[model samples]
Target: MSKTQQLSKIGNFFRAFGSAVAVAEATRLGHQPVASDLRALGIDPVQFKSIYRR
Candidate 1:
């Protein structure tokens, strides 16, 4: 697969996983772990925070 396609697939996986995790945690704990949510979406909060801060 092309690099773009691979990246897109990864993104899709992250979105699906993140959503699932958010729902599960909301059901079990009554609160969402936002960092875990981002991680499920294949994102690192530390990395994102750094980039976003700029």
Candidate 2:
């Protein structure tokens, strides 16, 4: 892969990792995670809410 593509992939990976961490922290705190963060993790925010159903 090109250097630019490799860098892009790394950046995306970090962003997704950050989103996952944010989601975990929010859930741990008994709060709903941000919709954008859920999307970053390839999750549908609405479905996630339904599954949790609080």
Candidate 3:
């Protein structure tokens, strides 16, 4: 991969990782997670809540 493309991938990896960590921490603390962070991990916030309702 080109240097720029590799850098972009690295950045995306960290961004996604950060989002996952934020969501996990929020849920652990009994707080609402950010919808954008959930979406970053390919989760739909609405459907995710519905799963808990079942």
Which 10 successive residues of model 2 have the least lDDT summed? Answer: 45-54
TM-score per candidate = 0.50, 0.89, 0.89
Q: Write the per-residue lDDT of candidate 1 for residues 19-53, one digit (tens) a residue.
A: 77675675466543477666766667576455422
Q: 1-54 in candidate 2: lDDT tens per residue?
A: 999999999999999999999999999888899999999999999998877544
Clashing pairs in 1: 14-41
- CA displacement after TM-score superposition, residue 34 of candidate 1 (Å): 13
lDDT of each: 0.66, 0.93, 0.90
lDDT of 2 at 17: 96
For model 2, the local distance difference test gives 0.93
lDDT of 3 by residue, 1-54 (tens): 899999999999999999999999988887778999999999999887765521
Alpha-carbon shift of residue 24 in model 3 (angstroms) = 0.3
